[model samples]
Target: MSNERLRIALARSGHTAASLAQQVGTDPKTIERWVNKGRVPRLRNAHAVARVLGVEVRHLWPTLNGRSEVSGPVGSDLVAVYRQRSDVPIETWKTMFDQATESVDIMVYAALFLHEQISDWNGLLRSRARAGVRIRILIGDPACDAVRTRGEEEAFGHGIESRCRLAHMHYRPLLGVDGVDIALQATTLYNSVYRADGEMYVNTHIYGMNAYGNPLFHLHRMTDNGLFDAHAASVDAVWCTARPLTGEIPDGSD
Candidate 1:
């Protein structure tokens, strides 16, 4: 009944039919049809186009639910979007354990969420690692240039670095545990990423801004090559560049 969603999305992204078509790898006329007639693309292409346009598919087609409205050539999976990192449910964050089969990976500047949100996480990881789940966590090095720059930009002074140090304390319990790897990096983290098998939660970072306010994406593995892979690769790249936080980590409590 309404087509303003598609109209608004195009306007917000500043994407024209030609530009969007080029990014989505579709015909310009196809985009024209979407804009002029409010036609929706197939599930696979819808996700492709949404990623290109930097939006949730539902933002373009507001009337539909991703589960019902989309069905990929391979499978129907969602890439849920949130306006803020906190918008995602706690259960969704915890559900990573349920979904993870082979590994669990996280890359963040300071994982205050892990410290403040979850309870008894050390015991939880002990159980998971004992069960053969390989866990790797990467946090920012407090003394690194990237942290210093970010601290100044956020106007938090040394607060960001302090948080990173606090995060190391929270993770101290897992320091020597088998199958758990913790590292620190000086990389310029443009996005905070967390991955559990095929699903990934990513939050984009804005200049001089905290990560919480940035738009977050919970991308499910709907295709062989999609946003999930891109994010996973990013985590791997950072991991390779990072220095392992080896040896005994001092156990500091809250």
Candidate 2:
């Protein structure tokens, strides 16, 4: 009955009103009415709607004790995970991400600069750093230049540059003499989507899991486990001596 809920569900599935109607075996006009005229579908129709959209029946009927409406804690395994060909849902992912404790380390071959929401994630990472959660990023050197010139001594242009500047100012340490918590690293061929929060780790495949082209993969779970641990240690070592991105380099010779 919630119009917004129905609309969001449809958007998530990339459904057109007409396509949705055909999928549910309803008339397109009826779906149009439900979406625009604020008409709620009947129970039988709702089931059809949910079924065709690959959504839970409870999502359409909130009062039906629908377990799908519940929001679990961040570290919780979801009741179901729906995979579609699009970027991960930011809002939902954030709720899960916010629950991370201890640390997050990202090793990526390439990263498109960031989404608008990423600043919040960056901030969250900073908070995690303060709380003793280690945060480390291993980003491709090529990707780094997209934001900042590799060896040039000036700040990148525009407002985003300021955000980049601030990131380094409050940046938490993953290593060095005073460092203990977070570590981040990068490799040119690394490409898997890896996230670890608390004891749970989820790896989403941008490339198929079986593909060996990605440098980011772990060979054996045990071997990779040790490697990741060692990688984290190395990150801590680098962060210790690395100048804060916000501050000018001491030599001023670069």
Best by lDDT: 1
Worst 10 residues of 1 by lDDT: 69-78
Could you give the C-alpha RMSD of every candidate to the true structure, in order shown? Answer: 12.7, 14.2
Candidate 2 stretches with Cα past 4 Å from truth are: 1-87, 113-115, 143-190, 198-254
Residue-level lDDT tens digits of model 1 in 1-254: 43455665566467887888888788999887877887877777788776665555664564454345345543233446678887876665765654365788899988788657777767767777888889999988887888889889888888888898888878877888999999988898888988776657888887877888788977666566566777788989999999888544323232
Worst 10 residues of 2 by lDDT: 211-220
Cα lDDT for residue 39, model 1? 82
C-alpha lDDT of residue 95 in model 1: 52
- Candidate 1 lDDT: 0.74
